[model samples]
Target chain A: MTGWLGSLRERAARITPGTLLVRGAAFVFAAGALLVAFPGEILLWPGAAVALVACGAAPALAPRTRLTTMVLFLAVGGWIVATTTYAEPVTWARLATLACLLYLVHTTAALAAVVPYDTVVAPAVLVRWLARTAVVLALTVGFAVASVVGVRVVSGQAYLVAAVAGVLLVAALAGLLTLSRRS
Target chain B: MADGSLGGAGDEDGWVPTRAFGRAILVVGVLVLLAALTGRYDLVVLAAPFALGTALSLRRRPAALPAPELSTMDARIVEGDDFAVRVSVANPDPVALDLVLVRLWLPRWVRVRDADHPYAAPVAAGSVAEIDLSGTALRWGRHDVGPLSLHGVACDGLLVSLRVECEPLPIKAYPATDPFRADEAMPRAAGLVGQHHSRKPGEGGELAGVREFSPGDRLRRIDWRVTLRTRRVHVVSTLSDRDAEVVLLLDVLHEAGESGGTGGAASVLDTTVRAAAGIAEHYLHRGDRVAMLEYGFRARRLRPATGRRQYLTVLEWLLDAKPAGGADQPSTGAFGAHLLSANALVIVLTPLLDQRSAAMVAGLARSGRFVVAVDTLPPSLRPPTDGAWGPLADRVWRMSRENVIGLLREHGVPVVGWAGAGSLDHVLRDVTRLASAPKVGRR
Candidate 1:
């Protein structure tokens, strides 16, 4: 009993205020992305959103696992299914917001995995991480907007362009992986 | 150190890709393929950040591993004194490290505040990040500060370097000497010159007697008052102020009770060591030669010397006085001759836990040594109280130990329980008187 209590106390000491904030941000972003995907449904009442919210909140429990990736993909898959099946209007602003939220979830969860619970993290580390994340989000939005405007300029068959764009994107991803392996 | 569990080092030397990197590629590929087949162009917005972020982060992989340096104060420090262990992790690569994780390992005797947990910090390119862990050492001994483990996480946790280990630093924590003062003369003065006064009449500060003027007696020593009173030429005589040799005999045959360190409850070894240090410091400061000897299997000894340097050496010797099995009578008797001087005062610090310690004390006294047996067992220590006869057993043990102490004292060895300052004064006074008395010569 004493050993158990001591281990508990040891684990408790490892939780710092900074760790709490990062984990809290991970949970909020995950739950928020899922909620935004399913509009007009109560957070607790909807079966699909609640289940996806649980998956999103997995990072709060164990951020270092592949669970965070699973949650992000599940929420995106849910969003894609809801939009296409129900014929909801796909606004670029909504897409961008969802994109930022999903990215934020990934960024925060990744930070949580590396930083120990009891770490005396320097303020500059978090500030710099947030700054980098902001830069990435802004640049992503710029490239996204440019792609959208460029696609609008093309007249005629949208599905044909989508097929070509998707193939190119897949090829680019495969190339990135290959290059990363070499580096 | 990089454990094999961390996949050791790859062809990149230190860098290992993280789960986030693989997740990014997989998620981006799946989303774009699904969007292309489903004819939904807006899905590209969701996939854009993952692709862009991974691409930008991977643009720079650290070419060199982080360097971790651990440093501590190497000089000897007293127990319970606050000390700091400095740890610095330097990033030599051009890429800024997103996070650096550091873990510290310390000996059981050391208590570094908040160092029980790992630390994380950021080091910019070609810069160093430092963490100072400060705390008190709780006991006396040679201890290691840390074998600090360090690793760097860069590219937003997409990659990590293999652990960089810094070797542990040896720190000698000397026992904290208690305030001990003995307001009595040493029983014997065996050395040529120092603080304690000797019996023989000589040129010194302590007056021995007033006698009639004799040949070779300097006029400066002439006592006018004594000459006038006696109506004869008289001179003041003084005892020679010679140093004494104090041999601290630590009985390391048995160690009893728990060592709670410094301010906590002391065990037999703790009491013995602290008392020995205090006693040595007191006599050494007063210009007396101090020596040390262990009675266990090792039977280590330090020669008698008077100085600040000997005091430090004595503390160093005390750290190695761990308990071992008993030395046979013949071995103990053989060492008794060389390790002891004719007029040296022997202070034996023992727990008196068994017959061997009591026999050793008796043997020293029988050998005509002016031996003082200091009972070093903590007063609060008690036997196990778990079974039906626990209290009874404890009572019997106490009675037995008291009997041994009684026997030792009856054999002319002064057995006294160690209390700080002035604890040995009465016994020392009696021993000094005994030394001044006449004794029969052994043929």
Candidate 2:
């Protein structure tokens, strides 16, 4: 695992600004495609755009700039989740959120691998942000997936709980992948 | 110069939190609050991984680390010589560092082919890494050894880098003489006026020929008019066999002038040394007690000695001597004092740049030594005929030199102007011929 982390770090060092831009563009295109596949998902558009911009800006900004952008990302993400809490949760909305969350995961992992370890004085702050975002995205996705599975099994309100658990599991997988790549 | 102001204040006193770390905290805190309020588990889950990564990132240290102080054990080393350097690295922090990269900078002249033992390895904390550095001192002058840079990285990826100016080491470069040249100039001991016996007999002490008395001959050497002069000009010519002490006076002053840089070109000093060395060698080989007196900032005298060792010693000293001071007049009294007892020959090798040395040589000639002034001044260093101050200065310098030669000639001293580009043999032959001429009374 350590060797893999070392390799990832080396790869990150070799990544030029051009490559970073290409990767960010690719993520955005992929998100757009997913969104187009589900036209009903209007909420995913903004989330995808924001994620793309954040990823694209990651390479140019120093570590300090990255931290500021991350803060803004968290604030917007919170507002979106809060405003939609009263409305019926849509499948498209959940998927779009998951995409944005995954984008954050990849970007953060790359940053951790690239930044010199000695330069980071406050790792806990960054770690907390990543972990919290991962857990929220996972639980939301789990709730949605479990809902579908529970309906086929029992056709009852118990599906909501299952859906939440499924969403949590997916989010957990994303977090694990991101953290593993970084380590 | 304030004590507290050195290297500025400490990290706490002038700490600026990086923008990245601060934003990371703010973002993560807001996301957590939103997740708790809205109960959006996905957002919460996403934040978890970022938090963990941030924690890991925090473990990394700042890159602005301090440099290590480096000093050498021995500063001076001769060419083709090697010496050890003791490098000490001090980590002021209480915590120990895992990996430290130290690079020592050396002068371009010195060829550091390989350092002793492991050149690159980990260095311990606050301890000295006594690495044996061995390299040939290829050239001379003061060389900068290093501004040694130290890059320290902790196990957790935090790095502290520092660069410190190391103590400088000075190496002197001395000239190496050609052994072949030394062997060719062997000394002997069988010349009149030298420390050896001479075959020539004359009134100067050693028996020469019983010649007819010449008019104006010293009465003391008359031999009671040689039996009523034998009714002919008969005189007893006794040659002095006493060892003659020859002192080679060399001028090492360099003056600003055009040196004839063409075929067979030579600098003023170059011509002087060669002439001095060649004459010294020639006289020494002829069994004369030869010595050298160098007149420069202060007069340096090597007492008369006859042997191969003494010749080599003189050559070594000549090779090491360099020109001193600006275009000031050369000191004559310094050379005159050294030439006080020299009865053989007093050869002055100079570019004849100024009046002081010329006057000194003139004084020596007046003292009755066989003063032979070998002028190494080339025509190129002479000023043009134009009536400008520059030309005037050169003319004055030349006239001063001429006056010295004239003064020496008046005292029956032989002055050889070596303007030819051939061997010292040409100049030596000229001096000998002139020295062999009969001394005429000054009109």
Candidate 3:
């Protein structure tokens, strides 16, 4: 056990400063999602904390592995179970916070997977990468917020219709990209 | 710096979706399904970024592959000198490369510090990114700095370009000569001008015994006291100062032990090359005509010349030195005895590991060429102890090598181990004494 810990410590020592920063950000985002999900529920805090720790550590250890995906699934699934069990009132601010946290986890993990732990990475590379991520997050979340406000101003049935239309539009775009692959 | 055109027509474009794309798509699909089942709009917003980020990143694919080029800045350097290698990668497509991963394949002797780790850099559209690596060239010989490999990621981590390879740049590292100096004069000086004092009768500083004044003797050399005491006209005879020709013969018949570069345990080839460089530098500095010859599978020769230019050429030639001639089929066909000057001092750098090497040394002595053999073998070399009889085999090898040296000494060939400064002093002194002695011809 001691030898294994020493080996783990040695491998961790090789991680470049840039990569360590990305990993540290991923951990903070993952843990923040859990804390927001169970704000007033004290009894469910222990299991939520364990799931949060797993989400943080998974990407740090092996970002490319499927184990990270499984841990993510565990965290998301635990959030859903807690919300269903507790008769809690949902608010837009809380939901938006949860949405942003989940997006941060996915993007950081993707960056970590491609960048090797011991590689020499320029600061501009990480900055440009984060900047692009910010652009995508701002566009998608802003559009969704506008869509929600506009739909609510109309009717209940129209809100459901807008949601279904958005899904169909995304599907059609996916189909177009697959067909254009040969050309 | 190396510069290359990117996106050649012949290159195959390898663009594919990474695992991140699949994971993002999976999370997006699950979140949407949950939104529909729970009748909650919040869940759909949670999935929106994953779906849009993937779509935006994959919207535009790179039309061309990247180009990579490798180059070294240092023109010529001796072993243990610093060198720099620059790897330049160009992104030709309109889509900016998110990250360009570059790696250099370095030779064992040429060390580019921090080249072991790969580099990740971002290149703007139609721009080039360069990685400069600097380190020491630890050992002598020709080495390549590259074959820089480049693979790029674009539009976040969704799209990856095919790996591109560049041709390697070759650099020559010359042998680092050890500090060497020899105070002894050459056995025979051949040229009319040089630092060595020759025994031939001529006008010079060093005086020989006073002799009876002859018809050709100069009046300035007259010993007035001796002439007055003996009632005979006597003149001081001075030896001529002439340049000597030195032929460094490398016996690349066999090699033993491992080379640990400069200031480390040396192999036979390492010892031979470094010692030759040292001896050549010392003599060439003193205005002696120095020449080099290899008695291996191929006879490589550099003509006798006296200058700093010749010293540089000698170092360049030694970079290609390696053990070649086999023990059984030792070839001296290319190295003819006629190539050697009659009065030149031939110093053969040999390990004496093969019987043919010893035979060649004896042959030089037989040909009446003043030859001095410097042993290139490292004394601390030990045989591999794999099994029971390893120690016994090692002992036998050492004993036989000692016997070869003894026989070469008996044959009037002076054999000595290479010890930097004054390495050839005793041997040259002995050879010079023998040259001055009278010859007894057969009746």
Candidate 4:
């Protein structure tokens, strides 16, 4: 694991700015695809578009500008969640779209922090970053799909409690991973 | 000057969190935990990306951090010569390094030619990335090149490794030599064997005269035709070529004007060392014994020696010598009189900035020692002022300098500006002529 991670870090160093832009575009496209997949939240379209653009263009913007954009993006995300809370029942598609948007923000910010504004990123490195983020998103979507199927079969507060338990389980698994990394 | 080796292995082999990493953790932790408490499935989805990223980044640990190695082709060079330095950082683990920034510390004497000083480059995992640092050495001195700082980041800046520091490299640039040469013959010759023709008749290649053969004369010396015509045992007598000692007295008390090194303004000391080197090489090449004496705050000497090897030895001493006294305090006369050989031609190289050095030249002249003071001061130097008093002060300085030279002329010491080859020809010829003329002795 150490050797594998070391190699990946070494490869990351070789990434250029061009590759960064391409990967960032892909992340933004993935977010747009999520918006299209869950068209039930019409109000989220403009907010999602703005957040994606802000995050995608973060590298080119000044640090202060990016900071402001991030703050605004978080506010919009909170509003979207609040507005959709009472509109309809939470479905697997809505959950998947939310997951994709969250991952897109994380990936965009991470890439922006790594490379400067003017640097030309290597293609292979950007692809590697995208591939890793995609794997995580796919896994999260798979969990949501499984939960939705389980809720359909057994509808009640019991299933909701189970869903909460599942969230706790994933959180605990993440904590354990962090602890192992520290050691 | 920092040395090349930075810190121990223990300090360099670890992962450290950057500000970005910390921010990521904070944002992920707060948002996800809030969503879990409220039991909002949509909010939980919103927090999933950060948690996954944090978990994945921390789950796999990288091996030892990259180690940097800095090297250069040549440490010792002449002024105006450019040298190439190679900086290679080695990654032992398979993790690709996304970003690596290296900042090098260079002395003022060196200027980078082709690239920016603080370099940034990318390195693939488990490989070495080399960067070229090309620069020209501007001056002659001992300089240090580095103790470079390296910043490495992996996993798209999510993971930043500990900064690595390297050591400094030492470089020495030697002074350039002028084109001055010395005369083949001296006024007086003391060594038995040399290349210069002497007045005294003896066994040599050049014909001196045809005279009656004297006892102890070699049979080969007898000129048969002269003996037959004069009805006597005449032998071919040739003038013996003897080597003479040339002592270079360098006045290192004061150095005036700016020194720009190669292709630039020459300071008094710059021209002085170059002229000294040229004279030494000229005399040494002609099989004449050469010695050097530097008098400033302290005196240093290289005993009279002959051969090409001793030229390098003399140059080494010249390189190490510096004008000791500051401009405020005039240098005292500290001539190495004990190191002088009898009838040695004393060529004093000085800018004549102080009266003490001028008086020393006068004393050497009065003692009947053949002396020549080569003016090492550049004539094109301007006074350090832009106002009306600038030209006035410069004129006053020049007038005083001329008066000093006139005094040396009165004492029969010829003062000449260094003009490369044949710079000492006329003065040496005058010394030879004076040696033959009759002079009044002390009462």
For candidate 2, write residues B1-443 as lDDT tens digits.
00011132223322122333334444446555555555444444434434444454434333234335655555654334555555565554433343344556677655554321112233334443334455655443345665454444432221223323455555433222111112111111123344333334533655676776677777666555665747665667775554556777877665445323222345566566656666666556655677887767756778888778777667666655557665653455554554556345676887666666666677776665556677777655545667658777876866776776677667555566664333334434545555556767577
- TM-score on alpha carbons, each prediction: 0.92, 0.42, 0.86, 0.75
Full ranking by lDDT: 1, 3, 4, 2
User: Over the stretch A47-69, how does candidate 2's per-residue lDDT look in tens digits?
Assistant: 76455455434433432234325
Cα-lDDT of candidate 4: 0.69
Write candidate 3's Cα lDDT for B1-443 as tens digits: 01111234212466655666677777778777776666556566767777778777767768788888876678588888998877888888887888888878888887777787778899889988887888788888988777778778776776666667888888888888977898887888887777877878787777868899999888988999999999999999988888999999998878789999876789999989989999999999999999999888777889999899999999999988887847434345667677899999999999888887899889998888999999988988877967899888888988998899999999899999999998888988999999878866555
* Deviation of model 2 at B330, angstroms: 7.4
Candidate maximizing TM-score: 1
The docking category that best describes candidate 4 is incorrect
Q: What order do you get sorting by DockQ, best first?
A: 1, 3, 4, 2
Model 3 chain A is weakest, by summed lDDT over 10 consecutive residues, at A157-166
Per-model C-alpha RMSD: 3.0, 14.8, 4.8, 8.2
DockQ of each: 0.53, 0.05, 0.37, 0.18
Off by over 4 Å in 3: A1-10, A34-48, A68-87, A147-151, A158-165, A168-183, B1-12, B29-39, B203-238, B325-328, B384-397, B440-443
Name model 1 segments beyond 4 Å from true.
A1-13, A39-52, A155-157, A160-183, B1-12, B225-231, B325-334
iRMSD per model?
A: 3.2, 12.1, 6.0, 6.5
Candidates sorted by TM-score, descending order?
Answer: 1, 3, 4, 2
Each model's fraction of native contacts = 0.57, 0.03, 0.37, 0.23
lDDT of each: 0.81, 0.49, 0.78, 0.69
What is the per-residue lDDT of model 3 for residues A31-149, given as tens digits with 9 covering 90 to 100?
67656665457436667566666666776566677655665565566566656777565455666666677777777877777777777789998899888888877766685665566
What fraction of the genuine interface contacts, i.e. the true contacts, does candidate 1 reproduce? 0.57
